[model samples]
Target: MREIFIERRDRILRIAVKEKGQLYECFIEEEEERNEPLCGEIYKGRIKNIVPAISAVFVDIGHKRDAQMNMKKGRTYKQGDEVIVEVLTEQIGNKGAKVTEEYSVAGRYAVLTVNRQGLSVSRRIKDERIINNLKNELVLPNDVAVTIRTSAEDTDVLHVNKEIDSIYEKICDINEKSKYILKPQRVYGENSLLHKVLIDNINNQTSKIVVDSKDDYELIKKYIGDEDEIDVILHEDYRTMFDYYGIEREIVSLRHNTVNLKNGGQIVIDKTEALYAIDVNSSKNISHGNKFDTAKNTNMEAAYEIGKQVRLRNLSGMIIVDFIKMRDDKDKADVLNALRKAFYNDKTNTRIYPFTELDLVQISRRKKGKSIYSYIEEKCEACDGHGKRLKLSYIENLIRNEILRVEGENAINDFYIELSEHYEKSVKGDIFTFLKEIEGITKNIYLNFVPGIDSFKVEPLLFKKQVENLAKYKVNNIEFC
Candidate 1:
């Protein structure tokens, strides 16, 4: 019950993911609104900076941005040599675009990395001779960089060789036409949005590719072949594609992760700077009193969400998920095995480990760059990303302390107390009235919801500007700006 769709926007690409007719995830290829993915682009550029200390170099790839190369994460090369590197990460930050000397350009069926560097047949295809046979047929098209794409699996050798040759000839042409040894730059070949989607997502479960544009059809046909047997389906009307599939309503929900589980438990997923945390909670139907049953129920619910998230968001690297703890080791084993089996359909290679000492399950997946969330959403302005919410009991304590301090002052006018929402809820109408009875303080105090428990602010409401000026100056460390 898994499905995926590729939607081309302006020039950028967005993926539509669904499980059992429910839309689970959506991903924009990058930050740009229009115009295709940039990975596997062969660019000619001048060395911008070469720092031996960092063992990194930056190159201006003649686009609006500079291409970066790290000798550590980047391959080794001496300075001032005019060299070719593929665009690994797009430049959109204070940090330049990430580029690698060791890179591959992808196409349907296979990924072609530079030169005769041996073949790595995907684990899905175990036929070693099939790969060797393809490699033997691959003759040099005059030493231009290329890597065979995964989509090229079972592809005709003659067609693969012809397309690869066409790409290599184009790379050589760029080198010949470049204006200078150090200053001038040129770009060779890059894939369109439709082309990239097929190579990246068109695997075992891709039922069909629904393309609204005819231009995409020709490009897809060019690379993957126009045979009727291919799953690439050209759409005459996009309305039918979405209406028959409920793609529109599903995409809207994916914007905010409100993942619901079938077994009557829910998980709240919050992404933090340190790591992504998933808190499993028991919902209405899943209120099993036994610790093992409850833990297994929620963990099983969480496992389904995790599986959908792996492909939907294309999350990568180290992930530490907090699953509700269980007393029995057998219940733990059951949940762990379920999670492992859930990820079997994932396109990316995923490694899952049992719950750690912190009661957190650790997962690792390979990532190319920034996450899917970072590409689409900005951090919340109010919370400012500490993810610390408010509590009622905490507010009661702070208010009691503030009330006692106010009565002791004898002559106090107005004060501003800034705290998190949880704290404010503790000292709202009824609680505030009951607490004030103990101190009988004759002072006006205002409460400000500051989003996090660690955050604190004090203000003399009457003497606003004076306290405000000192407000920015006085902090925990007092590192005034």
Candidate 2:
């Protein structure tokens, strides 16, 4: 059974999708993004600068920075001319948002495009009857286009038609606003996180929708009112819905580099600036008798996991997977087939290529918004993105050296080393030996465990009385000689 669990906390909404009680996907929406227009929003922008060399223009879209857009072929826009634009990507780092002149509004089953005028269907929907039916059924205004989403396949005509009408109405509204709104600003935005989760994930197989927030429960209940088959439940447990459903643990696992498979195998996922690389390792899989059999089985398991990880992490662009080497050609084919089947239902446009001569399978997935890591984790300030930190032993040695330097200057004996409580506890045993070694050198070397300090700090006190006075308060986790 497919179930969606939504939990709102700290002005952030977390949505987790589970199939048969196992986590399938997870999404987090911050409050700022929920309330403000970011990506996938239509705006009325004025051309600020036109770089003819690059064939791109910068437009003032009322954001902190102007958005960058590629010039549409045959379309000329002078400075100060207004144009309707859609945000294709959000402002990332030093680069401004990437916008497109061709504006489109997405709905559950259809996307209404204001610039492109034609009826298009999702390539994933292959049924001739469904394609023909959608082509004939969806009605749009002249000069407007609509693309039938894959979710519309085998859907009720009424549902698809209703969504089309809704999206077209939104397009009309945005267009109307663009005409009168003098300043560059957003005209239309995508629906809320709840609406998106329901539209994109809740299908025939989805049996239950659970939300911890009462307001969210009502909103979801009202949105899916037409569908009586799906049950919307309000979780009343004291624990957050994610914790109750084991989704919190699953979310934490996403931060790790290694993922364990059920068959005593593991897949190590590494992301570089250029592309993502996944390596499959067959460990302790003795159930398979032969080497070829074990390689194929582990590769198959990794293939399925790769599909899930890509979606869960929102890993986009080029991805290469190195699977266990198998001699049999048929085994490779079977693994590739299994990989294709795994991504068949993915919403993103993912293409899996045949294994290369180097025995690596390449995949290219459409770039979406930021990956799950961007939302859930931040780069470690200490490591500076290198994913490593200074060893506690090294830090202890550095602190000892600093004290020795101070001792050489014949400084006051009443000295205190202030460090974070966490760091202090880690090196507490070493601190005892160091204090004994320096007992004769310094009258009283004190240790102060500041709550939020990241590293150890050494300071020389003028008088022993001062150290005694500071220790009287006992506010910090301080240690005495």
Candidate 3:
């Protein structure tokens, strides 16, 4: 059974899909209140410059950076030409948003393509009769092209044709209004995440859809529109739907570098500036006597987990996986085949190449938005983004200086110092002595320990004035005292 859970977390809407209790996919979208740039927004952009050598053009789309459009062969563009484009991918790192000339507006049943001429059906639907019916029966405008989506399958023929007609008319209205526009503008913005999730997966084998917010539940009901097979549930329980389904735990685990497989194996994922490196590790010896069989089994497990992790984390760019060494040619082929099959359900464009001479598998996936790591984790200030800390004595001296500074202020009766559990253990003796000295001066001093915080905080209990003294001291790894 498939279940979808939607939760509104502050200004972000998080969606998680689970199939038979395992997380299949997850998405994070900013709420409309935040007014963030979405994936499917259409913009009328003016061409700023054309680089013929690269076959790419830069356009001013009212974003901080110019959007890039990769021109196809025989396609010509001139400066100051106003072209309508859709955002293919959002800005990543220093690169601008990737835009495309071939724009598509997606509806629940079909997607209307502008300028691109072709009637295509989703590859998932294998019924030739259904494909032939859609191809022959659906009527679209001459200029507009339509692609029958997977959701169109098993749906009423009249409903599918009506939806196609409605989307075509909507695009026609947008084009008619665009004739009067003189500058760069947005032609259309995609629907909210809730609507998008329902539209994209309504025809799938989803048995239940749960939303925490009543407003969003109503919105989803309106989008589903009289479809009663799928249960659209409004979860009014105090516990969130994510918590109820244990999806929150899975999301939290995405931050970890290691993933444990079912068969006593693990995969470690490391993200660098250029690419993602994954290493497969077998924790226990296989019960099977044959080493090749054990390696193949572990490699197959890693391949499936890699696909799941890539989707869960929304990892993109080049990925290199170091699978357990398999000596047999057939074993290598089997592993590669497993990897390809695992990514069949992925929505993003992904290409997997065979193993290299060094036994590393190379895979490339389309990057649509910020990675999951960047979304959840921030650069550490104390480590200066290196993910390491300075010497213990250096931190201790920094703490001493902070205590002295607070003691000199004499504004409050008590002082509180908060440090991470690790740092607390390292400086316990020094902290005790410092607290005793401060107690002599102010008659009240306290030390608190917190987890995961490398730096320490010093504050006056009465005045409520806190000072982060780690910044005032320079980091010296070599110096001890």
Off by over 4 Å in 1: 1-13, 17-25, 29-37, 63-65, 72-79, 126-186, 189-192, 203-207, 230-245, 285-289, 316-318, 327-354, 365-481
Worst 10-residue lDDT window for candidate 2 reads: 472-481
Predicted candidate 2 versus true structure: per-residue lDDT over 364-431, tens digit per residue = 99765678777655444444556533445334544555555566667556667776565554445565
lDDT against true structure, model 3:
0.75
Per residue, candidate 1 scores C-alpha lDDT tens digits across 1-481 of: 4455655544345566565666655556543522322655666666767887977787766665567787754345555566667776555556566776555555555455553355555655557887787768876444434456555666678877777666555555655766444553435554443455555655444455555567766766665554544465666542334434556445434446557777777777666655666677766545777767877888877887877766666667677777777877888888888888878756556899877777788888755434555553443334564543322332333344454455345455556566655434334435446335323245554545565454345444457675564454322222213
Off by over 4 Å in 3: 31-36, 190-192, 239-241, 388-481
Per-residue alpha-carbon lDDT of candidate 3 for residues 266-314, written as tens digits (9 for 90 to 100): 8999988799999998778465678777788888999988999998899
Candidate 3 matches the true fold with a TM-score of 0.78
Model 2 score (lDDT)? 0.77
RMSD per candidate (Å) reads 15.0, 11.3, 9.7
2 against 3, candidate with superior lDDT: 2
Clashing pairs in 3: none
TM for every model, in the order presented, reads: 0.63, 0.78, 0.78
Candidate 2, position 31, lDDT: 70
lDDT of 1 at 279: 72
Candidate 1 vs candidate 3: which has greater lDDT? 3
Q: Which number leads on TM-score?
A: 3
Question: What C-alpha lDDT do the candidate models reach, one value each?
Answer: 0.58, 0.77, 0.75
